[model samples]
Target: MTTELSVILAGGGTAGHVSPLLAIGDALRAAAPGVEITALGTADGLEARLVPAAGYRLETINKVPFPRRPNAAMFSFPFKFKAAIDQAKAILTEAKADAVVGVGGYVCTPVYLAANKLGIPVFIHEANARAGLANKLGARKAAGIGVAYASSGLAGARVVGMPMRKSIAAMDTAALRPAARAALGLDEHTPVLVVTGGSSGAASINRAVSASLPAIAEAGVQVLHITGAGKGITDASGALLAGAGYRQVEYVDGMQNAYAAADLIVARSGAGTVCELAVAGVPSVLVPLPIGNGEQKLNAADLVGAGGAVLIDDAGFTPEYFATEVLPLLANAPALAAMSAAARAQGRNDAAEAMAAMVLEGTKQQSTGRHPKMGS
Candidate 1:
């Protein structure tokens, strides 16, 4: 009798990690009908909700963050980290996990250590152009390492691309354009620009879009502005701002429709956003968040290099920039088409399946008493 293949997907905290985790889970299930998939995350992380909502069991552990400097937490870090590792080991043992796939988050370190201790194969996927500390440590002994960017800095990592939602990955933009425009109440004949700052929203992008609404309308462009939740643009009296051809919503549950309806996108250069835009063949103006370790800029490199996107720094993505750069680009159909083609060329919709295959293959090798090659 063939025993079922059991796998543990580790990572959480943010949508960036959880999104890819869920995608890999779905792909694994698709590839192996009887595979058992469980997710490891903290109760407070987004995975606590998204993982279960996606129909996979989630195992919770206390978040153990590595302190950057000497502090109280750093002093107690050893005990906390050990406890988390024990919890992970218990979960993995109970699940009989044949392999662990991590997408990179605070939760991954303990899980990686636990899997290593238990002698289970570990597969890692790094979503950022620059490797996160957790992933950098986990990659040391990972049986397979997959990265969304060529410059991820994980030694021996394969560029498998970001594992994205099926809604965006399997989207046929051209076929869905008309219905998507109608659904969003946008005119099919007019150029449509979709603006978003992700779920929590980007204050800078929101401010710039609000300031450029009149210019956007004057350029015969319809705007679908997804202001991050509760971050809607308002006027002096606190009335929500409105323009001739602009539609505002606090959030969009699924982005496929928005991508289909968009002739152009102006948004942050998050790893997920960059990959999704490329997959959907949507041209974009990417404004890297002017903070953090500059990973957002690194994440935008491939798409920008591919000529699918134009990168603008956050400070420069103002109303003046929009008028001089975006409006002119909106009027140029040929440029948009070329950008779309370039974006598509850089897309890898098969990333989830590719990662899934690696996990299963590594698991099979472990079961056969044969070691899988690293980075294979």
Candidate 2:
């Protein structure tokens, strides 16, 4: 008798977490044809909108973050956590999930514990080089683990790379360069530099890039600067520089065009951004966010160490850095070509398929009462 397969993807809050969860969901659906996939998230997270928009059922749970320090919230943490676990267990039962796939977020904590309590296996995917609290806790009981970077420090974590969207995964920069450039109102034969800071813009990057835009334009390269929503031009904090061949926008919905048209990219070193840049084969200067556990630094290490990209500290990412380092790189065709090649070599476009297969394999093993495979 064939056992019907069902899955619960527990991840949310940020796009970094939600995107991978959706990719895995898409992969499982494609691979199994009739697998029932449910997403466990919070109503406030991006997942609430993204998950349902992706055509998957989303079950929301309470947002009970793990406290780090002594506080009243910390004192009440156990009760809140228990409540989340109870809610997760109910969702898991309703979905009749065969496996719980966690992409790393607060929602995963309870889902992981609940799945383990129910004797159902958990699969984890860590998107950062520095593992988060949720993934660290989930890893202990997880049947299998996948990491985006080799140095993620999760025991038995296999480097699966980041699961990128289909548009980015299938993009051919050279073949689509002309059309992409046209779509962005860029000139053919002109090198285009696309600068962005993900969904929420980075102030440091914006200020530095904006200040250096005039000089950058003098270098004969066009700039596509996406300042992000709510961080528009005319802001006192970070103003835009108006110049010929300089295009500024708050956001771009279809980033494939931006990536395709770009000869070089300037952005933060978020795991998703790093992976997307590598897969798109666009050379970049990565500035890791100054906050957090320096995961962005580790996320960009593979490409930077491979000579595909450059790393600059947030403090050092100044207008002078842009003029002195970035402008010259834009002028050097051979160096740019080499960097692009290195980025492509470092990227894995089949990561989604590989991760999907791993989840299914782990599920099958769990059902058969056999030991799941471990290690990279």
Candidate 3:
């Protein structure tokens, strides 16, 4: 008899966490056609919208962040954590979950602790080189650890390169350009640069790109800019060349088209985004986010160190530099091709399939009464 396979996938608050969770869930669904999947997230996070939209059931937990100030966090931390843990356990139970997989976020913490308490196996996927706080807490504590970067702090971690959307695995780069360009109303002769600030938009990157549109356009390169929600546009279109169109979007539901349209890309170096770029064989100029956890830097480092990308610090992301850097690269055909080749060589598109299979294998082993715990 085939054992029922069900999972409670807990992770999400921001796009950073939610995107990868969806990718993994999508992969899991494709691999196990009969598997049951449910997502756990907070009521207010981006996940509340993204989860159900992706066609998975989403259960909300009551969670609040612990502030750095002892005086402030001390007053409310315990109650918040307890409520979240209780909610997570309820969701896990209701989902009839065989395993709880934490994709990383405050959402992961409660599911992890609850799974630990219930004797339910907890597994975590850490997508960055520098692990997030929640994933770090669950790293050794969980039964299994999967990482996108080999240098991740988890002691028994297996390097499973970050999973991208299913669309990316089969995307044909050779036929991508002309098709994407035609779809976007772009010319076949001009080179294209795709810049995205993620799903929420990047004010700095946008401002810098606007300042350089004229120069970049004059150099025979077009721009496809994906500015997330609430990104107010300026009157920079008049500055662009007639042949070089600047397509600005609030969000891109079809990201495969964006990757397919461009010769090179400029974006924040988050693990999920970088993995997609590598898998698509798209060359990129990675500008790491100057924020908590140094995750963007770590993600970019994984590619740049492998000769798969060009790393740019956020501080030096000036308009002139972008124009100068991008123009020369686009003008040089062989270099662009080489970068694309390197990006493809560094990617593992089969990672999700491999990870899902491995997880199923380990879970089956545990069912036989032999526990598998990672050594920290």
Candidate 4:
């Protein structure tokens, strides 16, 4: 009888990490019905909720952040990191993990170390154009490395694309457009622009949209502005400042609906957002977050290069830019259609399955008395 493949999916703290982890877990379960899947995450991270909510058994360890500078935390780092690795070892031993797959997060470093020490195969997937620190460290000894962007600097990493939810991967925007608009209470014929700054909201984006709302409405374009939590534009009466052809919400539960209803998207270009826009074939105006190691800007490159997206610097994405650029783009039907096609051309919905195959392949090799090289 063939032994059941057991795997541990590690990485969390943010949706960027947890989302891919869940997608990989789902793919593994689909590929091998009897596979045992357990998730490793930090107690306080988004994974605490999302992992269980996705119907996987979750194991948590203390978060160990690598200090960038010499400080008190740096002095105590070795001990804390070891403890986290110990916790990972305990979890992996108990689950009898045949292989470990990590997306990228604070939890990944220790999980990689533990899996390595146990002589189990490790698979890594980096979701950004520039790899994160944990993933950078883990990539050195990963049995199979996958990246969502070609520019991701992890050596020997394959460009397998971003693993996303089925709702996004299988979305048929054109077919679902009318029903999606009706569900969102939007008119079927009006050009719809969806603006978001992600879950925490973007103050500059909100400000620019608020200032440009009048012009947008005048152009027969309707707006669904997803202001990040607590960032809603309001009048003195404390009510949201929404008028005809404008809607403001702090969040949207299902992004697929927004993608389906949108003629165009105006948003920050996180890796997930950029990939989703491509997969959904939505034309976009991307204003990358002005912080970090320029990963957001790098994330937008391929889509922009393909002519599916327009890239605007954060400082230049003001009300004037919105009126001069976005308004005219929304009015150009042929251009929007071409942009949609270009974006679709870059979509890869098979990433989850591809990553899952790597895990299964590693397990098969292990079972057959052949082992993947420790640093291959």
Write down the RMSD of all candidates, one decimal each.
3.9, 4.4, 4.7, 3.8
TM-score of each: 0.92, 0.92, 0.91, 0.92
Q: What TM-score would candidate 1 get against the native?
A: 0.92
Position 376, candidate 4: lDDT: 12
How many collisions per candidate? 0, 0, 0, 1
Stretches of candidate 2 off by over 4 Å are: 235-242, 368-376
Task: Report the lDDT tens digits of candidate 3 across residue range 1-376.
Answer: 3456777788887787887788778878887876788888889888998889989998888866766676877887888889888887887777667777788887788788888877778778888888888888887667778888887787899988886667777799778878778887677778888889888788889888877767866786678777777675656474322224566767777678888988888999988889888889899998888887787887888678777799988888888778778667867778889998999888887767666766677666664333323332
> Once model 2 is optimally superposed onto the true structure by TM-score, how far is the C-alpha of residue 134 displaced, in angstroms?
0.7
As for lDDT, the candidate ahead, 3 or 4, is: 4
Q: Pick out the ten consecutive residues of candidate 1 with the lowest summed lDDT.
A: 367-376
Cα-based RMSD of candidate 2? 4.4
Number of clashing residue pairs, candidate 4: 1
- The local distance difference test score of each candidate is 0.90, 0.87, 0.79, 0.90
Which model, 2 or 3, shows the larger lDDT? Answer: 2
Q: Could you give me the TM-score of model 3 versus the true structure? A: 0.91
Residue pairs clashing in model 1 are none
- Candidate 4 per-residue lDDT over residues 1-376, each given as its tens digit: 3566778999998777888899999999999997889999999988898899889999999998999888899989999999999999999988888889999889999999999999988999999999998899889988899899989999998999999889889999999999999988899999999999987788989999898877877887899999986788997798889876889999877789999999999999989899999999999999999998999999999999999999999999889999999989988999999999999999999899999998888678764433322221
